[model samples]
Target: MALLVDELMTKQPRPLGRSLILCASALSVALVTGCTSDSGGPSASASSPGQQQKSPSNGSDLTDEKLGKQVEKTLDTAEVSDSDPLFVEAGLERVGDGFHSVPDLTRGHSYKLSVVCVGKGKISLSIAVKNPVRQTLDCDGVTFRQHLTSSAAAIKIDGDGMPGATGMVGWRLDKADK
Candidate 1:
């Protein structure tokens, strides 16, 4: 009976020991994760007196980056004159987006321009599609949606509030696939 009692006591400790070790490990991990996580906690450096907190991502892009890339890929970057043999300046047209007016795209010729993402929050990109291909333009992101048509009256490209950057917006030309 004494031996039997001793055997049971030994077996009880095996499970209890394992449980205690597991509990300790879990507690350690919980403490570490809570301390090291990036949940807007002030860094040790920034927590110092007279130091300010830094922002996470600049929040530069949302939807316009993807759309602007698509536009740039479809257009060409070369400049052509109204009488240039490779392509002709069919005309310029305005693209409208609610309250903002986009740059003028030339038809009868493909033009390529660049795009940029503004700082954090709102997305922005600019393109300079030139006539006679003569200018490197800084433009605004909201202006790309204003493509009226090549046949419209000579529309002007407005670079209002455009960041100083540039990108390839899109191209215009006939069905020749140039």
Candidate 2:
């Protein structure tokens, strides 16, 4: 009877020890996940004290009215004559890595492509045709223009922004007489 009683005591302790370990494991997991969870924490755009914060577009600066005005201004500044007609006037909204393509371009014609950002951010534009090219522009209300010697089937404009940035870009394409 003593032996039986001793055995029962020892087995009870084993289960109790297992239960303690299980509880500890569960607690550890909870702690780890709780720290990593996204509960409205500071995002990548957050900057430290005394650090210059970059102004990245968040899609609010380029409203429809604003974008339309910008496009009209750019076209006017481009001075498209009767010989050169406007091909495309577009507004692009980009977040992170985004692209816009200008389709149905004619070959062997002189073309001008212009882009400007309507908000606070930097936009990088690129042309993809027979040869690929790249350009970076600031959103300080300046228009960037590029002249194309040959017609391309499409012109690809790529927008690169900072982490968690959503910006608006306006573009115009003019076709020159052959």
Whose lDDT is greatest here? 2
Lowest summed-lDDT stretch of 10 residues in model 2? 38-47
* lDDT of candidate model 1 versus the reference: 0.39
Task: List the candidates' TM-scores in order.
Answer: 0.22, 0.49
Clashes of each: 17, 1
After superposing candidate 2 on the true structure, give the runs of residues whose Cα lies further than 4 Å from its correct spot.
1-68, 76-89, 92-99, 151-154, 164-167
Clashing pairs in 2: 57-166
lDDT by residue (23-44, candidate 1, tens digit) is: 9999999999888665654354
Q: Give the RMSD in angstroms, all C-alphas superposed, for model 2.
A: 10.5
lDDT of 2 by residue, 1-178 (tens): 9999988878755788999999999999999888755443445334455545555454454463465466457546434454544564444544343557655666677777777665556666778867788777676557888777554355565656544444456666666545
> Which stretches of candidate 1 lie above 4 Å from their native place?
10-20, 23-36, 39-54, 57-178
Angstrom error at residue 120, model 1: 15
The per-residue C-alpha lDDT of model 2 at residue 95 equals 34
